[model samples]
Target: MLDDNLRASRQTAHDRPDLQISFEFFPPKTDVMEEKFWDTVHRLAPLKPRFVSVTYGAGGSTRERTLRMVRRIKAETGVDAAAHLTCVGASRAEVDDVVRGYREAGINRIVAVRGDPPEGVGKPFVPHPEGYRNAIELVEGIRRIGDFDISVSAYPERHPQSPDWNNEIDNLKRKIDAGATRALTQMFFSNSDYLRYLDRARAAGITAPIVPGIQPIHSFRQIASFAARCGTAIPGWLAERFDGLDNDPETHALVAAAVAAEQVTELVDEGVTEFHIYTHNRSPLALALGRILGRRHEVAAVDAA
Candidate 1:
């Protein structure tokens, strides 16, 4: 089975070369982390991403910072910036204000999300009394404020709170009807799962581009924990790849790049041309994976050199 996967990866390595990629980033909370975040931005901006996004924190925790970062990215970088707008804690008016601010700052894109609960993942999400009720509503509200290229979230494995995939697809339809031009999926390891979800979405009349979210493993344990909370499944083979490299950063990074390269290569072979990379304020791994998927580097040759 492993050999078959490797053969497929090699076949893909020799074939597909065109890819349109975007990246996601979260706002930094400290001075040192801020420095690292800018370094990441500088390193990745050269790749010419479709657009780089800044994540809005749970319950609007990083609202100001998200805006500041998005504004700065648009002003300082050549890449287009997309701001994440959510209805977790802010009212409709507040969220609208943020949307207008993005327009004024020349940020013409947004990722509309319902966002996580204030208490954290797994906690019940109670919407603010005067806020938009959900992501679909937020999409509508953003539309009312300005003409922005809105992208809403999609869950390939079904959202944790959703009863089933059918219901999730219906919810996505509503978001599209509300004026979202694109749907970016939650992170999932299996390409087959994304393909199946895409089939279902198309069957349900969703014709917009559904970009798969690709998360390069910075720390297997950390990603596993997040996957557990967000209902993202980590395949056993993936876990096996990172099994005991927790303490060896060197080997860990090598394995991470390899795993991510294989994943993206297989996806590319399957005809997926667009990807969203979740860069957790780190660069080396995501940068490596980007170069690999674009066939800009030879993995073994880089390792050998």
Candidate 2:
């Protein structure tokens, strides 16, 4: 079984030169965390990702940190960096200012999301009295500010607040019509969910690229909690794979690499060429997954030579 997986990985490495990948990161809060974040960035930057994005906090809580990180990433690593913009606690003017800031810094890629309520996820999201109402409005607002390459969020399992499929896909369409060039999905453990959502989006006449969000589980407990909050289902088999490994870090890490590799390998077979990875500010698992998908660290190779 292991040999078969290795052969498949080698085959993918040889055949898929068109595979494109991007990484998502969050701003570090403490000095210790900041050191770790930069290390992760420097490590992964050599993979030549399409882009690396810094996430905004709920209600623009990490606004300044996010902006600062992206700027430094672009300057120091020469990687195209994207900033996340959200309409939650801020008004339209405030959000627009953030967009302008990114433009002035020469960072033009924006991930427009109608962020969770300041209260928290699963709570009712109340847009500010003077703010853009939803993601569609946010996308429009960003478009008016600059000719930024915009990306919006998509949900394969349906948004927790969405009533049905039509409402969900309609909202996504409205965002695209507003100027978003791409849609990145929320992470899902089941590939079928993502493929079915892609089919539905195509059938609905949404033509933008819908990139699947792949998350390598650094910690199953934490990821499971996030899945529960975001309406992503955790299949029983996935749970069984991680079962009884809490105290066994060595074995747990191996399982994590194999599981995530299997997920992306299957997606590649299904004709999905682009991926957005949620890195959670760690490099080891994400690096392992990238290598499985045939990404090589260019700088490391040069140094070794």
Instruction: State which candidate has the highest lDDT.
Output: 2
lDDT of 2 by residue, 195-288 (tens): 9999999999999999999999989989999999889999999999999988988888999999899899889988888999999999999898
Model 2, position 62, has a per-residue lDDT of 100
Q: Can you tell me which runs of candidate 1 are displaced by over 4 Å?
A: 1-17, 295-305
Candidate 2 yields a Cα-based lDDT of 0.93
For each candidate, the alpha-carbon lDDT, in order, equals: 0.89, 0.93
* Candidate 1, backbone clash total: 0
Tens digit per residue, CA lDDT, model 1, 135-208: 99999899998889999999999999999887999999999999999999999998899999999999999999
RMSD to the hidden true structure, all candidates? 4.6, 3.1
Off by over 4 Å in 2: 1-10, 299-305
RMSD of 2: 3.1
